[model samples]
Target: MRADAKKNREQVLAAAGIAISEQGVDVSLRDVSRRAGVGLATLLRHYPTREALLEALLHTSFAELTAKAGELETSSSPEEALVSWLRDCTAWTTQYQGVTELMAAAIEDVESALHASCVALRAAGARLLTRAQAAGAARADIDGTDLFALVAALAWVGDQPSLESRADHLFDVVVSAILTCAPVLGDRRPTEEVSS
Candidate 1:
């Protein structure tokens, strides 16, 4: 891409991020172009579609989250790692008004532009859940799909004005429900003693 084209694309994405935060995934493409101070033709030339734009916007964040899950897996306790990742996922999702809906749909649609990124993200969360389950920190019954769904549900709460205030508390509630027992500090417990 030419320097100017790259610059225009970046501007569009930044403006889209702002517009989406304010108005959501359904925000008008024209509004995004207007905000970016670019012509609609330029924005379309770069992204072509809402999903394409979203795919570009969400790709980096999704990669960071997946990487974070990996880092947490190594640096934190099984329970702590899972909770932290879940919280991060939920909080990040709340930044985009209707992203949870897109994510949920994208994960199921193999042909969708966002499918690959969503699947990778889901796999990352699943790894954390599996690790926690093996350590007797989380319930064995729930799988990665369940974990991803919980994140979407939790994020949806944060998006709603009425429920936004309760989002943090609800997050804790969901975490507790997912975990086999409350988190322990200091030395990790033997899986046998954890007693899910």
Candidate 2:
């Protein structure tokens, strides 16, 4: 690709990301082109359709997430690693909207790059979950597929700003239930009264 063409392509991807994050995946290619300050022909040259743009965005996001996961190397116990992963996942989920919708759409009867990325993400997440379980932190009964579903559902539920408090509550509840340790009963604080 020529220098100008490469710049145009980058602009289109950036515009598409913002459009999808703000408007939705259904945003028109013309709007994306305008957002990129490029002609519609140029936008189409890089991404043939809305699905293609969405695929590009999803691919980038998933790749970043997988890379982050791969870099997670805490010397803490399995529970700590699991908690760190969960916190990272939650923060990403809270920041990105419509990600699950795009992912679900990608898994349809369409052949696209997004499918491959999703598969990779699932495999990576499963590997992490397995390690965590082997170290005796997360519940043995839960698998990666379950973790994926839980994260997706939790993201949707916690997307709202007001729901943050509820999200934290839900997180604690789920974490307590999924951990192999003794249940944490409410908030444990040292008693101030001296029995002696």
Candidate topping TM-score:
1
lDDT of 2 at 19: 81
Instruction: Please report the TM-score between candidate 2 and the true structure.
Output: 0.80
Instruction: Give TM-scores for every candidate, taking all chains together and pairing residue i with residue i.
Output: 0.92, 0.80
Alpha-carbon deviation at 166 in model 1, angstroms: 1.1
Q: What 10-residue stretch in candidate 1 is worst by lDDT?
A: 185-194
Clashes of each: 0, 0
Residue-level lDDT of model 2, residues 99-122, one tens digit each, is: 766665555535855778877776
Pairs clashing in candidate 1? none
Alpha-carbon shift of residue 92 in model 1 (angstroms): 0.2
Model 1, backbone clash pairs (residues 3+ apart or across chains), number? 0
Whole-model Cα lDDT of every candidate shown, in order: 0.91, 0.71
lDDT of 2 at 124: 64
Candidate 2's C-alpha runs over 4 A off are: 73-76, 107-110, 161-165, 182-196
